[model samples]
Target chain A: MKAKIYVTLKPGVLDPQGKAVAHSLHDLGFDDVADVRQGKYLEVELTTPDKKKARADLEEMCKKLLANTVIEDYRIEIE
Target chain B: MKSAVIVYPGSNCDRDMQVALRKITGSEPLMVWHGDSDFDKVDLIAIPGGFAYGDYLRSGAIAARSPVMREVVRRANQGVFVLGVCNGFQIVAEAGLLPGALMRNRDLKFLCKDVHLRVENAKTAFTSHYAGGQVIRVPVAHFDGNYFASDDELKALEDNGQVVFRYCTGDGELTGEANVNGSMHSIAGIINKPGNVLGMMPHPERLIEDILGGRDGRALFKSLLKTFPLAA
Candidate 1:
């Protein structure tokens, strides 16, 4: 099984890097872009064949280490 | 005062902290490795600044879960005086020792310069040597020092008087222009509700000596010595 995780800063938290990227896009003539928020994407190869176990384990990882719940929210996709 | 400086991998400020502790308290502080589980008998524990664990998962994220931090969290809850500066502050917050999360600077830059800090709460053990509303010059060097907290949490921290320091102008005026990293409420440092744990972005150890441009940070260490005497 493989797990994919998306970690993003929570809404209302200032995303400076994203803002900078947005500015660069504008400089490149992408002026229609309103905003941009940067995030992390992780792909993990799990040995477990059980999707249920992988989902549960990924949730644990997200809460404990993969994300700082204080400022980030994470979503997990298992295949 | 008997102090212990936790040395994490890539910690650059542990030596500075040790030097400051030895000079201010006239006692050599114990150097505890990140893997060590025991803290022994110590009056103060300091987590110095650095890019711990290469700041992989997050700044101070992996280091906060290291073996030694488990003991740190336990001791901190038991009224032990714990101080975290710069990356250390990020570690403590990641470990849930303080409120709010330190995000990247508003301008996305690593700020390294002297900023004036106003003493907001001098009643705490860390700031008792300074008078309330006193402005001190200290240097801050970090990329992620923008403090952010929910509205209710911010209100609670304010109501409980946990905000110990706020960035301000030299004359002690809290203006938006004085906020270097865009920290919420211009907070440069804050203490826990019990006032035993303090986490701040500025490096007090860097400014403790007169030859180091300023001695504004010496009073902080002196204040701790007064509260936690070596004899005790």
Candidate 2:
């Protein structure tokens, strides 16, 4: 099975990288952009094809290692 | 005093911390690898600064879950003295030993220079050497050093006096930029609920000797040696 995890800074959390990107985009003449928040997209390949097990394992990975639950949220999609 | 310094793969300040410990305690500190399961019967454990694991994913994220941190957490729960500096502070916060997370600097720049910090609460094991409101000059070098915590957490910290340091101007007044990384409530350092474990973004190890700059950081080590009880 293959999985894709999207990790993002939660709302109200400051995202300096995202703010810098927004500023650069504005300087480049893209004035319509209101805000930009950057996030991580991780693609993982797993040996098991079971979605249930994969979801559980991915949740554990996010909680224990991947995502910092204090400031970030993660969503996983298994295929 | 017997102290141990946890060395991670990318830790660059382990030797500096060891030297500081040795200078004050009159004994060499044990260099424990990140894979070590045992703490080697030490009174103090220091997680020094540097881009641990190259600051991949997030600052201090990978290093927080290393094998040694598991042991560190266990010992910390037992009331052992633990100090985390800069990246080490981020690791401790990520490990949930302390609350909040360090985000990138608000200016989005890697700040590297000496800054003034006020000793907000000098009652903890880490800052007992200084008087409350005393200002000390320490160098902060980091990209992601902004500390964030919720309102309730901030209220709790203030109520319990867990806040230890706050950024200040040269004259000892809190200023906007002096809060270097935009830490909430201007918090530069804080202790855990138990007050034994301390995490701060400033590197006291770098300022222990006068040759580096000033000796303001020396008193911290001296105070630690004075207050720490010998193992029974």
Give the DockQ-based CAPRI class for model 1: high
Estimate the TM-score of every prediction.
0.98, 0.97
**Candidate 1 residue-wise lDDT, B207-229, digit = tens:** 99889998999988999999988
In model 2, what is the error at residue B165, expressed in angstroms? 0.6
What is the docking quality class of candidate 2?
high
- The stretch of ten residues in a row with the least summed lDDT in candidate 1 chain A is A48-57
In candidate 1 chain B, what residue range of length 10 has the lowest lDDT sum? B34-43
TM-score of chain A of each: 0.97, 0.96
Q: Mind giving the per-residue lDDT tens digits that candidate 1 earns over A17-66?
A: 99999999999999899999999999999998888888989999999899
Name model 2 segments beyond 4 Å from true. Answer: B229-232
Error of 2 at B227 (Å): 1.5
Q: List each candidate's DockQ score.
A: 0.84, 0.83
Report the lDDT tens digits of candidate 2 across residue range B60-145: 99898888998998999998889999999999999989999899888888999998999988887777789889999999989988
